[model samples]
Target: MPHPNPDAMAFLLSRRSRPAKTLRAPAPDRAALEPILTAAARSPDHGKLEPWRFIVLERGALHRLAGLVEERGPDLGQDADQIAKAASAYRDSPLAVVVVEIQKSSEKIPQIEMTYSAGAVCLALLNAALASGWGANWLSGWASHDRAFVEQGLGLSADERVAGIIHIGTETSAPPERPRPDLDTITEWVTE
Candidate 1:
């Protein structure tokens, strides 16, 4: 016999990511967010490599990031809207967690596996935030991909990559439920 946790399942089924732009103030306090980060850290990591780390960007940090985006814009040939969109994540966000994938040199654990673990951490963080009653969204723009931007903006190392920027805050409006994948089309049952 197996015990089923219906509430957890129901919550998973109903979880929807709130838009980053629509998230407002009064984000999770340190006490409130600590547990969520703990939950996120519980994500599966093969061989326990722990190839990921998080940078919590609060209000002032966001402003600094926004300023960096503005400063780096022209050099990257980004126009106003593009620059604005890149900066908007910081400009509007009350709080965000930058999931950084730190690639470790290991003979046993492959780099791809490390990358996957980092990705898992990103989703775990997002889900944790949502489960904790905070609106959260994962975002990565051109700035996130730019080498200079990552190094200068977030102080990432050569072996590190941005897994995602998980923005968390109060939800201003409820987003309508979007379409889900058709299980029949996506799944295949095999029998011998």
Candidate 2:
């Protein structure tokens, strides 16, 4: 007999990311978010490098980041719509956690593995936020990719990069569920 966590399995089966546009205010405060961060830190890291970090952006920081997005857009050759969309993500976010991928020097662990660890941390953070009863969405756009935007807005080091920015807040409306992928189309069976 095997002991399985039905509740955890149920949540994973039905989990859906709430769209950032539909999320409102009343995000988790520092005290409330501490456990979420702790949970995210538990993600697997090859070599135990812990090749990732968190940057919690509060309301004021989000506002400044929005302005920084606008300032960097033109210089980065972004169009008006692109700039607006990117800026709006920061402007409208009640709170966000930027998952910074740290490239650690490990002879045994390749850089790709470190990147994978960071990505896993991002998913863990999103799941933690959702399980805490907050609406959460993982997002990254042109602004997040632009070097100048990352350096100026996020103060990321040369070896660091944005893995994902997770927006957390109250849900203004419940979005309709979209169609999921067919397992047969994507799954593969190997007996070799």
70-110 in candidate 2: lDDT tens per residue? 99989988899989998999999999999999999999999
Question: Quick one: best TM-score, which candidate?
Answer: 2
Clashing pairs in 2: none
Give the candidate number with the greatest lDDT. 2
lDDT value for model 2: 0.94
Clashes counted in candidate 2 amount to 0
TM-score of each: 0.97, 0.98
lDDT of 1 by residue, 37-146 (tens): 89889988888989999999999989998999998888999999999998988899999999999989788998999889888888889999999999999998888888
- lDDT of the candidates, in the order given: 0.92, 0.94
User: What are the candidates' C-alpha RMSDs?
Assistant: 1.0, 0.8
- The reply for model 1, stretches above 4 Å from the true place, is none
